[model samples]
Target: MMRGEGQELLNDVGCICEENGALDLLQVVVGKGDVYDGIWTELQKDHASLQAEIGYLLQNQQKFDVNLNVRHFGKVTKSTIQADGTLMDAAEKIFRGTIDFVRGSADSVGAETEQVLLLGDDVVNKTIPVILCAEENVQGSHGAAIGELDEETLFYFGARGMDRTQAENTIARAKLEAKIQKIGDADIEQKVKTQLAEVLDRDNR
Candidate 1:
């Protein structure tokens, strides 16, 4: 939730040790101006697992830079990080995701992936995913997907009688739907949805 007229900087560091436990996190961000967000999650004990899902939308000439670090330190531990984003107007976003498998974390598994949808001509999107494994017995992987709408998809929207702009709005909103549905609180979810609709609708004008 980083939105304002002036630039914003946020650093959130979290370290937890889990034994036969799990942790899950979801982040949905809609912002203005320039923002730098850092999320750090580390330490997992034997049989522990961690999962993180992030969705961000930026418009106008705003810039959003986010960094996430996940570390595993226990045997048989598991972790996953997934991020999806959309950039409109001259906005830009930089996503840095890192997953580390430390020694003694044998048989650990770690994976990270990022996807970005681009809108407008001058928008910029960059993703840097790093995997560090100090244990040879662990498994780690990383990848990214970045692009615009394809003709086939566009046709699908048109068949449903949705104009280009309307179809795009639907697409943009869809990026965060997964995490939004997990909010559990009906009132808060509706408020967030209202805010997103207002922001996206305003940007369309």
Candidate 2:
């Protein structure tokens, strides 16, 4: 949690998967209030795999900077990184994801993807996805989807008698539902959901 105004928040993570080892990781970050967070994973032996997922929500001029790095140093290694984020009302966000395949890491596979939702004209979003390889037999890919809601999708809600404000609120809630479920504690999740509702309601006015 952020301590106070003008303070910074940062979290760094590192993991090593041994031979025949596997790891599945999930990360969630919410800022309202730099939140710099980084994760690094290394696969050092045969048949090692890593799966990483990250979710973030920022609003009200908040700022968040995050990065993920996955390194493959063994044969038949695999890694996948997925990131989902939402930014609203002058908020700023930057995300960088890299997958490195070292020599001798033949047959290794890696993919990274990012999805972002923009809800304000003043919001700023930047994403950099990189794949570095030193192995000819390895496979790697990266993709990003970032933008506001499409008109057709928004129309789907208007047809149901919802106004433009209502439509945006509904769409944002639907997207946030998935991340809300990622919250482990029931009480905390509910609290955040309630806070989100209040925020949206204020905007609706």
Best by TM-score: 1
- Model 2 Cα lDDT, one tens digit per residue, 1-205: 3223456787898999999998888766553445888888999999999988877667777788888889999999999888887787788998888899999999999999889989889999999888998999999999988989888977888888888767776767766668778768898788767766765664532
Off by over 4 Å in 1: 7-11, 203-205
lDDT of 1 by residue, 13-94 (tens): 5768579877787877875667777777666689888888888788888788888887888899988888888888788888
Query: What value does the lDDT take at residue 192 in candidate 2?
Result: 68
lDDT score, residue 134, model 1? 90
Give per-residue lDDT, candidate 2, residue 10.
Answer: 77
Alpha carbon lDDT at 86, candidate 1: 86
